[model samples]
Target: MKNLVELDKNHFIHPTSSIQQQQEYGPKIIVEKGDGIFLTDKEGNVFIDAMSSLWNVNVGHGRKELAEVAKQQMEKLAFSSAFSTFSHEPAILLAEKIASIAPEGLNAIFFTSGGSESNDTAIKIARHYWRIQGDTQKKKIVALKRGYHGVAAASTSATGIPEFWSMAGRLMEHVVHAETHYMKGTQIAIQSLREIIEQEGPENIAAFIVEPVQGAGGVIVPSEDYLIEARKVCNEYDILMIVDEVITGFGRTGKMFGIEHFNLQPDMITFAKGITSGYIQLGGVIISDHIHEVLKEKSKGTLFHGYTYSGHPVATAVGLKNLEIIEREGLVENARVMGNRLLKGFQKLQEEIDIVGDVRGLGLLGAIEFVQDRSNHQRFAPELQVAVKVIEALHQRGIICRPVTYEGVDIICFAPPLIINQYQVDTILERLQDAILDVRKQLG
Candidate 1:
């Protein structure tokens, strides 16, 4: 309470926040506790966490059982090496559980500290697999524009937004970006993705990495046919389909993995965030049977790709149990139901709010865009900082929601925990509506 803000200003370099602004205002609100869908601030003001702590925390905060799981692991062989002949019980069990819950044939799990590292690892493994199989020419990786993979060199190259890749030019060579489903021409948006395959020349393309629903790129959920067509193209050219499930996995998009919603089976799926629900850092790459075999047999020698904490016992233990609880408590099904409720609630707001442009989401993940004129589909100017304004207004109203910022478009994004019920859903929508009104008044 006493200049904690000053201390934060002195230290803490916040991600995606203005350094000058933080020095001026310091930390906005410090949350003291979270239970289920409600988060209580230091001042005891409670509100819904609409963004689910940067779109992770699938199980929500303050799960005593999860704490116990972490504690138990700490008590029983907390640290162990998954590298070269050493393994831990929790890590092994967690791997088994992941194999069971993941898509058919995603039996191998290579761990990482977070999504960025997981994706980086995936690219290395993919290239390694190809080179050993005498396909060194297949190093060309294709990703969708406006896609958000990670900020690391390799994964950042897979990231579609140029804003993330500006200072660092061409993080990964031969990484070509294709037209995203959201930014595509109408026919391409609605039609299949065959044109992309034709243009990129599938022979030179090694992998096509995509998110089931583009997360940081504004929750852009492509049509089912688009993903289906992509899978066909990958198969035709023998290209690996890498589904970056960093945001869409673990029931946020209503399914275990976003790829599960479609018929396409990815050769590799990189997962993070929800695996440990933002408690402990945890992530992994789920590889299909074919890739696994190729990786094992055809590898020139040692694959030589891993982190010190690749399969940290504590993280894996929590991740395994997290999946277990999501299944046992039927949180995924709840996300589907409550997500519909949240969507309808937003649509009702869109009816009254002339500025609202589009509203789309699944399960616990959703968002609504704001435009200058809905009728003409005119967007507000990028200089206006509309999304940032809405986020600040929401903070004032006590709820926490993230805004997806494009070149000029403002989309209010929400991906609360899957554990939220209908009542909590209503509360989140109500607070968001209030915030939207405040932002509109400010703009006027």
Candidate 2:
């Protein structure tokens, strides 16, 4: 087992990590086992998992019950294609379950292996739908400047982060980018979107993609009126409204979908992370009736889309069970109830810490923006890597959290497993306070 660490130290490469640092400093984490609300590393260090294992483990770790569902489905049939000819009971059941819970007009489901593929499927279907409707020029996808969709080519174009685009030099043709709410005022966000739409010409625009509550882009929650205005503009312009709920779906923001909280109608909703709570790889798009009918009735060709892992039976089974747990256990309402508690507790940290520039969130998803000098709203210099340091310090204390590096300032986002209670919240806040104080002290 020690050799395993040695081998990993010598040879393993990890995703979204500093490869050079790992080689020089050794492995950052050696997670061994996890249970509800907590995890332990190979060194026997234990801590509350505050970020829900990158914001997907909603039902929390060690869900033996969900495992049972997977075992049962695997026993019967493990993999099945959504390819036109084949059908599976678990897929049918999971679709019905999804349709029952998703927002109105989002009826049909197209499965993928995970969030990135779901975003890919979404963009293709959008372009195909426009082409089917005889509006080939309506191929542009506009996303907020700081929004995150996924890493696939099409998804990356819509992702809004210039860094994520390191894989591709520029956005794919006709894929547009817009302004996010991170700017100080609402007028800027509205004006930026309007100007971009006008410059691009609404006629050329096919879809406007957005995350109801921006997640990876720093959990920026738009003003109440922003989406309403965007919805009106899209309607006036005949552009499809695509809401990427990959992070905010399945009750992360106190609602089944973050759009549900905003009261806006989106033409499509892309989802994945929370679908099976990361117990299994599963993702899918929720299609509005208008788009669904157009693609089903007018579109020719193979729908020209699918993955070998699409609607994998075992994944669907776990998703179904994950949904069951969310419902029977009332985790959604629990998140709403408990999320408010977390927000309230976070407010205390804001009051106690002078560096905190702002604190904002919805349901259980919240963040605190740190500044070099809050009185002037002065941000710490980017090279200081203050947020990154805080995240690492928090991890050392056993709480996993992320520091969002964009949006004018750095932020530490709190999105624990929706299953957390007040006791756990307090415990986490205590460690987080220490982290906050440490950053403040070092920076000062």
The model with the greatest lDDT is 2
Model 1 alpha-carbon drift over 4 Å, by segment: 183-201
- How well does candidate 2 match the true structure in TM-score terms? 0.97
Which candidate leads in TM-score? 2
Tens digits of per-residue lDDT for model 2, 224-274: 888888888889888888888888999998988888888877898999989
**Candidate 1 local distance difference test against the native:** 0.83
Provide the TM-score for each candidate, comma-separated.
0.95, 0.97
Query: Candidate 1 residues 1-444, lDDT tens each?
Result: 757777888989988777898888887677799897778977889877878887899998989888999999899878888778588787788878888888998898888999999888888877877888787777878888888989888988888888887767766798877778885743564233456656767666778888889999888887767888777777877888899999988888888888888966788999999998998999989899898898778776555888899899889888878887889999889889999999999899999988888888877788889999988778999888888888888878767888877677798788988888877787777878888888888889
| Candidate lDDT values, in order | 0.83, 0.85
